[model samples]
Target chain A: MTLLVTVFAAIICTILWYKRKNDEMRLGTLCFLFWGASLMWLGDAIFEYAELHEEFFTPAPADMLNDLYLGLSVVALAMILWLIILLIKDPKGAVRRALQKK
Target chain B: MACFLVGAAEAIVVTVASKAIKASESKKELAVRSKGGEKAVDALREKQGIPWSRKLMWLAYLLWGGAFLLAYEHVWHGEVVPWFPFLTAMNDPGDTAEMLHEMSTVGVTMAVIVTVVWALLCVAADLILKRRANSPLENA
Candidate 1:
C-alpha cells in the first residue's frame, strides 16, 4: 500500500518535473525523494513476498489503512522539506523580495 | 529486519565525504574571492558546473530518506524494537542469518539502484548545463 502510494507520488512528481522546463521549483528533488522511497519499498515488498508467498496478496484492512496514512505522511513530509529547501535557496527570490519590503 | 541499516550506513559515509568536499570547495571559493572577489567566485562556479559536494549531498539525502522510511515501516511491523539488539530478528540465529541475507541482497540492490539514479541525474544536469553554456545566446 505504501509502495503504491509512493509510486503514484513519484509518477506525479516526474510529470510535474518534465512539464516545468524552467524548473524554478526544483521538482527534481521531490521526484528523487519519491522515487528513492519507492525503490526502498520495492525491496521491502520483494522480501515480504518471499516470506509470505501467496499470503502477500492479502493484507488486513486496518493494516492497509495504516499504510495509506503512512504513505501520505511520507509525501507530506517530503513536501515540507522541499518547501524548506526552496525557502532557503530562494531560487525565485520571492521570499527575499517580500522580506526587503518590510 | 535490519536491511535499512545498509542504506543508513552508506548515507552516513557519503554525508561525511560531502561535508569534507564542501569544506574544500569553500576554501577554494575563499581563495578565489581573495584574488578577484564575487566575480572570481562566479567564474569558478561557471567553470565547475555543479559542485561535487552538492551532488554527493543529494545522494546522501536520497539514501537517508529511504533509510528513514524503511526503518519506520520495520518498526511499525514490530520487526524492530526500542530495546538493545533493536531488530527483533537479532534474537534468533536463524532469523539473524536471514536478515543478513536480506540486507546483502534486497538492501544492497536498493542502495545501488538509488545511487545509479542519482548518478544519472547528475550526468543529465551536467549535460544540460554544458549545452546552455555552449549556446550562442548565453555568450552574448
Candidate 2:
C-alpha cells in the first residue's frame, strides 16, 4: 500500500520535472525522494510475499486500512520535507520577495 | 525488522566517499588556479561533467531520507525497541532468521533499486549537459 502511494507520487513528480521550463521547484529532488521510498516499500512487499506466499495478496481489512493510513502519512511527510527544501532553496525567490515585501 | 539499516549503511559510505571526492576536486581546482588563475579554474569546470561527488551526494540523500522514514515506520509498529538488542525480532531465533532474510532480500533490493535509478539519472544528466554544451545557442 505504501509502495503504491509512493509510486504514484514518483510518477507524478517525474512528469512535473520533465515538463518544467526551469527547475525552480526542484521537482527532480522530489521525484528522487518518492522513487527511493517506492523502492524501499517494494522491497518490503517482496519480503512480505515471501513470508505469506499465497496469503500475501489477501491482506485483512483492518490491516489494509492501517496500511492506507500509514501510506498517506508517509506521503504527507515526504511532501512536508520537500516543501522545507523548496523554501530553503528558494529557487524562484518567492520567499525572498515575499520577505522583502513584508 | 532492521531492513532500513542497509540503506542507512550505504548512505554513510556514500557520504564519506562524496566528501573524499569533493576534497580531491578542491585540490584539483586549487592546482588549476595556481597554474592559470580563476579563468583556468572556470575552464576546468567547463570541461568537466557534473561531479561524481554531487551525484553520489544525491544518492546519499535519497538513501538517508528513505531509511529515516522507514526506520520511523518500524519504530511506530514496535518492531524496533530502545533497549539492548534494539530490534524486537532479535528476541526469538526464528524471528531473527526471518528478519535477516528480509534484510538480505528487501533491504538489498531497495538499495540496488535506488543505485540503479541514480545511475540512470546521472547518465541522462550527462547526455543533456553534453547536448547543451554542443548547442550553437548555448555557445553564443
Candidate 3:
C-alpha cells in the first residue's frame, strides 16, 4: 500500500513537471526531491512488508537501497541549491542565457 | 548522527561563504555598471541581495546533507546491514567501513548524474525562453 502511494505520488509529480516544461529547472528540482524521498520511503515500506509476511530473513537489500536513497536526496538538494543560485543571480537573464545555448 | 550533523554544518558554512563571495562580485559589477551610466534596471543584478527563496534552498541543502548522514549511520548501518544477511555483505570484516564506502560511492554517483542532468535542463529551458523573448510578435 505504501509502495502504491509512493509510486502514485511520483507519477503525479512527474506529470506536473512535464506540464510546467517551460519552468523546467524549478519544477524538475522539486520533482527530483519528491522522487528521492519517495524512493527512500519505498525502501522502508518494502522492509516492513517483508517483515509482516514472515519473509523478514530474506537477505533484504535495505542498506544498499538506503545508501542510494540518501545519495539521491543529497543530489536533489544540490540541484535545488543550484537552481536557487541561478534564480538569484538573474532569474530571467539566467533562463534566457540557458535557452540561447540550447 | 554525529557524522550527519557535522556534514550539515559544513554544507551550511560553505553555502554561506559562496554566497558572500558572489555578493561581493555583484557589488563590484553594480558599481562598474552604474559608473558607465547603465539603466537603473542593471542595478537589480547585484548578487549581494539574494532572494528569500534562495536562502531557503541553501537550508534545504544543509538539511539534506544531515539527513544523508543520519540515514547512513542510523538506518543504513543499523537496520539495513543486519537485514542483508548475505555472504557477500559479510565479505567486509569492518562493517562500518564498508557501509561508509558504499554510501560515499552512491552519494558521489548521484551527485554527478544530477549535476549533469540539471545543466542540460537549464540550457534547454534557457533556449526556449530566449526564443520566445526574441520573437518579433512578442516584442510588438
Interface RMSD (Cα, Å) for model 2: 1.6
Q: Where does candidate 3 clash, by residue pair?
A: A98-B126, A98-B127, A99-B126, A99-B127, A100-B127
Candidate 1 docks at the CAPRI level of acceptable
Q: In terms of DockQ, which candidate is strongest?
A: 2
**Per-residue CA lDDT of candidate 3, range B111-137, in tens?**
333334434655665576667768999
Off by over 4 Å in 3: A1-32, A35-102, B1-18, B36-93
Q: How many residue pairs clash in each candidate at the backbone level?
A: 0, 0, 5
Q: Candidate 1, TM-score vs. the true structure?
A: 0.76
Among these predictions, the greatest TM-score belongs to 2
lDDT of 3: 0.49
Model 1: per-residue Cα lDDT over B105-129, one tens digit each: 9889888888888899899999999
Say which candidate scores most in lDDT: 1
| Model 2's DockQ score | 0.47
lDDT of 3 by residue, A7-65 (tens): 55457757977887476345545455445444444444454555576654343587446
- Give fnat of each prediction, in order: 0.42, 0.41, 0.00
User: What DockQ does each listed candidate score?
Assistant: 0.44, 0.47, 0.06
